[model samples]
Target: MRNLEQVLAHAENHCENNGSRLTIKRKQVLTGLLISDKALSAYELIDFCKGEFGETLQPMSMYRILDFLNNQDLVHKLNLANKYVACEYINCNHEHLVSQFLICVECQSVKEINISKTVMTELQRNVLQVGFHLVRPQLEMNCICDACITSQA
Candidate 1:
């Protein structure tokens, strides 16, 4: 994985290439997620901005910024947790189909992983068989992390 500075620079370049600017506030929000070890809700982001940068952000405004970041694929929203995390593939140059995450139930640690094309196809087929549309095509699995399990033992 690239360092924070490297990732941020890549994101800036990506946005510019796509004709969208990564504004200061959006950058700040992305920075907050990058520095965090787990997903964060919008309210938590508001507090983070206020504490770290001494800048107050309204909830609605934060949501709008988050929406933009999500659309830009700079960050991803965890539907199950109602929180956001920076995309792990932000620095990658190749296109990827992001579809799943492993979330540590005990520690809230998040790890992004790609599923095989065959598996994705099967999952989509199953959803279609049930007469439900897979709109997001994302999955979040809950499990105990190694650290958490070791500590428990």
Candidate 2:
């Protein structure tokens, strides 16, 4: 609960600074994401809102909210799994160097990682060599988690 409050507070401050309004509905969506252990799709978020808050959020509305959250740097969209996760480093805006997502192919679990600056520079340089610019340097890697691999074995 305390953690949620802190996240909420940070979000509020961020919204204020960025000239954006974090409405109650947006907060509700963010709360759902924060409480979930795994990345959640928009439909999953809608179900969660209905189940937990007794409110129904339409898919279109959810998409708008997700877009706002992503713009605010409060959420990340995992392309591999087509799900959203609240940014783990919510309080530190400066710490966002390059976010790497390690996704478990079997269970859709995601782990956020930061590679060293040297590595990030190298990656950017390589992309430039190929005539591509990285708007945001994020790498999504697909792998089976240890638990999944062990279970399979």
Candidate 3:
């Protein structure tokens, strides 16, 4: 994983290249996600901003920021947990592959993994065979994280 400064710089460059601006609040929100060890909901982000950056963010505003970040692919929304995490590939210059999330059901920790093109092709084929078009190729799988499992044991 890239350092926070490098990731943020990469995100800034990426946004500028896309003809969009990464505003201060957006940076703050992205920073919160990058620093967090787990995915965070908008409310948690609001709290993070208030506590960490001494900034007060309204829920609607926070959602908009999250939406912008998601659109930029600088962050990803984990639908299974209804939370968001910073994109792990922010510092990478290559195009992204199909991404899957391993979400810890017990602790809500998330890990992003890339699926091989061959596997993604097979999955898409299966989807098409069922007469359903695969819209978002991202997958979110629920599981227990190592820490959670060890605690249970």
- List, in order, the clash count of every candidate structure: 0, 0, 0
Ordering by TM-score: 3, 1, 2
Against the true structure, candidate 1 reaches a TM-score of 0.94
Candidate 1 C-alpha lDDT tens digits along 19-108 = 999998999999999999999999999999999998899999999999999988899999878899999888889987855888888888
Backbone-clash count (model 3): 0
The CA-based lDDT of model 3 is what?
0.94
TM-score for candidate 3, please give it: 0.96
Q: What does candidate 3's lDDT look like per residue over 113-134, in tens digits? A: 9999999999999999999998
Highest TM-score: give the candidate number.
3
Q: Which candidate has the top score in lDDT?
A: 3
Off by over 4 Å in 3: none
Question: Candidate 2's residue-wise lDDT over 1-153, tens digit each?
Answer: 238998898998999999999998899999999988778999999998899889888999999999999999899999878899988788776857678988888988777888889999998899999999988777889988898999999
Candidate 1, clashing residue pairs?
none
**What CA RMSD would candidate 3 show?**
1.0
